[model samples]
Target chain A: MIEVHEIVKKYGENNIVLNIEQLYIPKGQCFGLVGNNGAGKTTLFSLLLDLIQPTTGRIVSNNIQVNLSEEWKPFTSAYIDESFLIGYLTPEEYFYFIGELRGWKQNEVDEFIGGFQDFFNGEILGRKKYIRDLSKGNAKKTGIIAALIGNPQIIILDEPFANLDPTTQFRLKFILRKLLENKETTVLISSHDLQHIVEVSERIVVLDRGCIVKDIQKSEETMQELESFFKDKISLT
Target chain B: MIRLLQFEWKAFLRSASYNTHLFIKIILALAALYLVILFFSLGFGLYFILEEQGMKPFDVVNRVLIYYICIDLVIRYFLQKMPVMNIRPFMIVNLKKNTVINFAITKTLFSFFNLVHIFFLIPFSIVLINKGFNLSGVFSWCICILVLIYINNYLNLLANNQDVFLYGLISVVCIGGLSEYFGLLDISRYTSPIFYNMYTGKGSLIVLFLIIVGLHYVVFRFYKKNFFLDGGLSIRTRSVHAGDYSWLNRFGTTGIFLKNDIKLLSRNKRSRSTLLISVLFTLYGLLFFSDGLEVYENPTLHIFAGIFVSGGFLFTFGQFVPSWDSAYYPLLMSQNIQYRDYLNSKWWLIVIATGISTVISSFYIFFGWDAYVAVLTGAIYNIGINAHLVLMGGAFIKTPIDLSKNKNIFGDKQAFNIKTLLLSLPKLVLPIVLFAIGQNIFNSTTGYLMVAGTGILGFTLKQRVFKQIEKIYQKEKYKTLKAYKAQNNF
Candidate 1:
């Protein structure tokens, strides 16, 4: 479980992004964080990962405070941006390096990464091509697969489907479902594609500017209501 | 065409504001140039004083002008940038080929070193004409200086454009060997009448000027034809995982950092070239060391000689360590790692580099085993003193350096503040002062032993000093970062 209490982030003198009160994310649930551009989705993600310090807040996970525990780091995996991908190494080498960092044996790393051979359509593994040379969609696929390598309890993906092709997008959705079913991995995904977010996520949270505007769970009539609500809100803007 | 020149000038000046240090350096360069002119005038005044005592002024002035022209040729060759700057932009433009070529040739005139022809040669020409030398003589020498400058500029551009360094080693060997062989045969003198006549005073200045002009035209024509061709900037695509190093696992983070550091250093042309040049200079000193009375008379000069010989490793190795990670420093900082480990890794790298250099330099110790031992002693002192100094300097002196740009070894833009100078002064002056003190305190053998003992102690204690410095680095990280960013515009 992840808990954020009174998180506030400021750039210079202005509090451009903020989190009021408290929020909790239970284990084994898919949470879709939907926000428009400049809506603090990335900043919030950065804060959770401890990449940047929050102006004022307490973040806790699994009875351990966020900044004080190595447990939080080991169980959490994030791909914030393309910069997260080390460009100098081939996909295979990069995967192996990340696996080693997680203390995985060579045989284990190779075996696990080898499972993605078919997923990549035989384009990535053992190709001896740097990540910088890979196309945007392929690079994203590489990042996602690497994050899943150690089977972390929580995976945070930012804009995972933005640059992917339609076929790849469908495949990724299926892969996420399978991972959820098997490992009960709690996934937090941020996206602007409302239709896809609603389809994949069990709980949807709407963020406008920096504050959480609405939180809803998917139900029998919730999808229809969400579609109408989203349309009204966008039209009002 | 004039508008294009104006645009180029505006763009250049606008880019200068990108870094405050770079803007200050440009101003400093202008002041330095003015000082050089003032020094030259003072030397001319001294010559006038000497010439009044029955020595011929024309001969002295002529020799001075010739020497200046030679130095100008070398300086122009190294500093000229017109060929690359002009040709690159013209490659994709709709401008006519001849027009582009004409611009490139004319741009050579804008180089500051070309002004030497006007300053030195023209003034000397007036003196020669007043002294009743033939007008042809004055004109010939002036034209010769101009032709020499152009020849040097064009040759340097051609060589650099063609990736000449790839073939440079072989070319040097071949030329050296051929010159020696021809000198032995005694028939080499007949092969080129120009060289023979130049030595014998039969060479006309017109013939020399015409030959250089023809060579310039040929080179210009070649560049004009291939200016837009993609031969020069071809990116080498390679298989990324060509070699896998399983050994990296054994050493952990240090191994990873070292491997990555080496890769970054090797991939960057500027950094790698600087390292190579430092090694080459070490070898030059080793090859040139001589035991002479003139050099050893002053204890200060002796210690200075020792420091200069071993100082290259410290000066270049630690100078750009932080800047090498400028692009990805934020990422590195975010990782759960200690600042001490980062500094320790840098210290070890300097030790390794300095060790290799000292081994190479030991071969040229001319004063027998004593000189070799002194060099070894000095090398240890340099490692301890200079390495600590660099870390201490890094803690306080915050100057952001762009790793991508090539910086001269003694460039004015490098952080040469009072703080850095004070930090460096102890490294340079203390060893000499110690050696002098040791010499007075004991017999020659015991004095040498004292100096060597102190060096060993310093080397051994370097780690302890580095740890203290690293603590300071951690505490002052934000201040250092702020100062670093403040020095740069972006």
Candidate 2:
């Protein structure tokens, strides 16, 4: 579980990017975040990961202040972009490196990656290619899978499905569903795909500009409501 | 064609880093101006020096031309980036592919490597004419030299990434130098006549001209065949066998970091070049020791050489510490590792490399006990004090390095900026100045002890230094992450 209190991220004077007064992500929840371009989705994720300092406020991950102490790092993991992947390392090397950092033995790491054979599509491993040489979708798959290593309690992914193929997207959704089956794992995923967001997450939060506009428990008509809300915003412009 | 050039000009002027690029360019131009002045003086004075030796000045110059071309090729290989055409944007427009390729090839003719010739050749030709050589002969020879220089320029572009061309030329040069040294074969006897024939108004001028034209067409055709967006613009990827450094995992987190650092050095082009430069630096003491043991007694220059001899890796790789991982820094920060452990691993890596360098530099002991001691103490100083200074310097660095870019000496502009220049004062100068203070008050033995003492103190206080550096790193964490995210597209 994570608690964000009075988090305000500003670029300069008169430009507030993210200004969330209070946001809580409960344990074992499949939390989905939706936002348009420049809606501060990535900024919010960066603040939670402590990649950037909040102009005013703090983020607490599992009761540990992320900025003040590093105790939160062991239990939390995130893959926000290509910057998460080391370019020179092969996908296998990157996975093993991260696994080693999280205290997984080499054989254990190998056995863990073996479960993702279908997700890898046979193109990621045994290809003698570095992660940098892999295609964008494949690279994204590598980052997402690497973050799943070591069984972290909190996993964050930004735009996880953007560059993925349809098959891998479905596989990732299945993976998330299986992860949420446990009562302690909290998975936070941000996406632009509304349909996938509705199916994969039980709780969907919509952000417009810097404010959370809608926090709805998924229901039979949740998709229709989200579609109509975005349509009205477009027409108003 | 003119519009294509205009597009290139606009892109350059509108770029976000234009001011920084312009500043670096100005500095490079000033440094170049100094080199040109030195070359001009050498060329102008060459005829007089040869005359005093009772040798024919023109003949000697002709013989040396082959050596010049060989050296020029090596320098060009390192300094010249592949000429960028930005052809991707223009590919969709209404234009002939030939026109674009032709424009790219023609643009390469104005490269600094080609134009820098005028600085040396023009002065040499002026001296020949003043010395009363045949005017027409001098004219033909100068034109031939210029043509050969262009020939080298095109040959370099054709062989830019070919290891065969680079290594073959190096071996050939080494063999030729050795042969000349041992009196096996005199290359000048063969070269002097071939070039001297041009000065005798022979028809070799036509041959040289044809060779240059042939090379130009070959380069043009090569670029044409590989003009696709992904083919010519991207760094070529070769499948490399994964190396196993799992033996290092026994040391725990620092070992894991060291393993990753080794992969980084071996796999990236830019980082691999630093390894090559460090290997070269191990022999740097040769410059001081070659003058013999008596001249090597100058303690100041000995310390300078000793620093280079022992701290080769510290100076080249240490300066780029966290920037080496700038691409994946956020991943590092978000991971479960401690900051002190990260810095400790880097410190260990440097200490291990300096240990190797110091062992190799024990060859300097052949000079004298004093010479090796100077190197030994310098290594201690590097391990104890300068390692921390270098990491502290890295704490202030916010630039992200493109690890794959191998050409263009100024491509890694972070290597030459004002911050590094200011940091080098403490990293390089302070040790010698500290030793001088001790030596002036007592003996050279006291100075050496003083330098080693400071290193020992720093060695013992590693945790305290890391605590302070960790604070600085924590403060700059977000700012550095922002910079890397902004500039690092690779």
Candidate 3:
């Protein structure tokens, strides 16, 4: 679970990027955040990870104030961007590195990656290619897989579907569904793909210019409603 | 052409680190002035020194010219950055390829290497003229040397990849030295005549002029053929090597960190150069010890050489602590790792590097036990004190290094910053001062023992030092992350 209290991230005077008064991501929830360009989704995620300090407030991950203590790091994992992957490391090396940090043996790390053979599509492992040399899609897959190494209580992924191919995107959805079966793991995924998000997340939150506009549970009409909301924004502008 | 020049001017001026660039340029100007004065003095005294030794000054200059040329090339290879233009922008714009190429070539002529030779050449030529040599012949000889310097400028284009040129130069020197030793060939006998001819007639000047022009054509054609981005300008990617360093896992998390550092140094171009330079530093004692065995009598210079011999890695690669991970710093910061562990791992890394360096420096034993002990004491001092200081200094360094960029000794902006310059003072000065205090009060053996004792004290209290360093790192974490993010724009 994660809590955001009066989180306001400002670049300079008069530019308030993220100003969320309160946000509570409950345990075992499949949370999906959707936003347009410059919607401050990444900024909010960065604040939660404590990569950047909030101008006015703080973020608490699993009851630990992320800014005050490093305790939350053991239970939380994130794959925000290519920055998550070491450029010089092979995918297996990267996985083993993350695993070692989370107290997993090399063979145990091997077993965890083995489960994602279908997800990796044989392009990542045994290729002997550094993450830098991989195509964007493959690199994204590597980061995402590495995040799942130690089975952290909470996993945060930003724009996980952007660079992925359609097939891999579908596989990622399946992977999310499988992750949610545990009923204890909280997966936070942000995406531009409304359909993929709608199919995967039990609850979806629409972010518009740093404000949470809609928070709805998945239903038969959810996809149509979300699509029409985005459609109206294009016409309103 | 004017527009292209304007673009370059604006790009240089508008860079994020323009102030850093300006400061470095001022420093470089001062250094150039110092070098000019130094070379002038050397030139003024060259004739007198040679006369004191009862040798012909002109013959000596001609004979040693080949060595000077080789040394110049080696220096230029490390220091000169190949003139670059963002040709990709011009490729789609309304610009001719020839014009762009010509601009790039012309820019090379303005390099400091081309101008630096004039400082020594002009003063030495004046000395030659004062010695009652023919004016026209001296003029022709100076012109020939200038032409050869230009030829070297163009010849350097083919030697752009540093490793190839460095290895080639070393081998050439070794082979030449061996042949000369065995009396198979006298390179000076052959090379001396070439420069002597320049002083005797104008024909060699014309010949040297033709050679420079030919070199220019070759370089121009080479650049022309590989002008496209995919052909020449594309980033060179080496074959991926995934070496298993799990053997290092015995030390636990520290081992993992060290393995990653190893991979980083071996795989990345910039870091690889740092590693190479560190390995070479172990032999730094050669500069002093090669002069004479009497160097052992001077504890001050011996201590200085010893510090460099083992502390090369600590000074060179150790200063850039978290910046080496600047590319993925956020990931490390957010990972399930303690700040103490991270700093401890870096300390261990420095210790291991110093240990390896000390072992390599054992070859100094052939010089004497005193030289070996001096190096050993320096290594202990580095591992104990300098390692902590360098890491602590690294906490304040927020600049990000582009690890993929090929190393240019003088081209890197981060290589010479005010913070690093200030930090280097204590790292280099403290040990010598400590040893000097003991030497003045007691004797040479007492100096070594006292310095070694101080290092042991620091080493024993390293845990306390790490606590303070970790606090600094924690305080500066967000600022460092912000700086890296701003520069990388990701």
- Fnat values, one per model, are 0.12, 0.86, 0.78
Error of 1 at B189 (Å): 8.9
lDDT of 1 by residue, A94-118 (tens): 6765675556777898898776666
**Which should have the higher TM-score, number 1 or number 2?**
2
Report the lDDT of model 3 for residue B116: 76
**Residue B212's C-alpha lDDT in candidate 1?**
76
Ranking under lDDT, best-scoring first? 2, 3, 1
Q: Which candidate is the best by TM-score?
A: 2
After TM-score superposition, the amount by which residue B377's alpha carbon in candidate 2 deviates from its true location, in angstroms, is: 2.4
lDDT of 2 at B224: 78
Compute the lDDT for candidate 2.
0.86
Which runs of model 2 end up more than 4 angstroms from their true locations? B21-26, B49-56, B182-189, B292-297, B408-411, B438-443
Candidate 2 structure quality by residue, lDDT tens digits, B85-188: 46677776899988988887777788878887877788888899988888899889889988988888888888877767877887777688779879999887
In model 2, pairs of residues that clash are none
Q: By lDDT, who's the top model here?
A: 2
Superposed by TM-score, candidate 2 places the C-alpha of residue A2 at a distance from the truth, in angstroms, of 1.1
- Estimate how well candidate 2 is docked, as a DockQ score: 0.88
**Candidate 1 per-residue lDDT over residues B1-490, each given as its tens digit:** 7866886688677653434565466666786688567645653454466578777665444434433444444444334553544466666678777777777667766666565445555655566577676776556655665666666666655655233442464344446445655765322234334322332343556677777778778767766666655544323344553454566546676655666656556545456656765765574443325644454555434555555566565676576566555443433443334566577667777777778777877775555665566566667777767777776776654555544344343432546556667887877677777777777877445545655576678778876887788778666654554454444434
Which tens-of-lDDT digit does each residue in B56-146 have in candidate 3?
Answer: 9999999888878877787777677776436666776777778988888888898878887887888889999999999988889988888
Any runs in candidate 1 off by more than 4 Å, and if so which? A1-5, A15-37, A45-78, A81-97, A105-107, A118-210, A213-237, B1-27, B30-138, B151-250, B284-288, B291-297, B301-308, B335-340, B392-422, B443-490
Q: Give the higher-lDDT candidate: 1 or 3.
A: 3
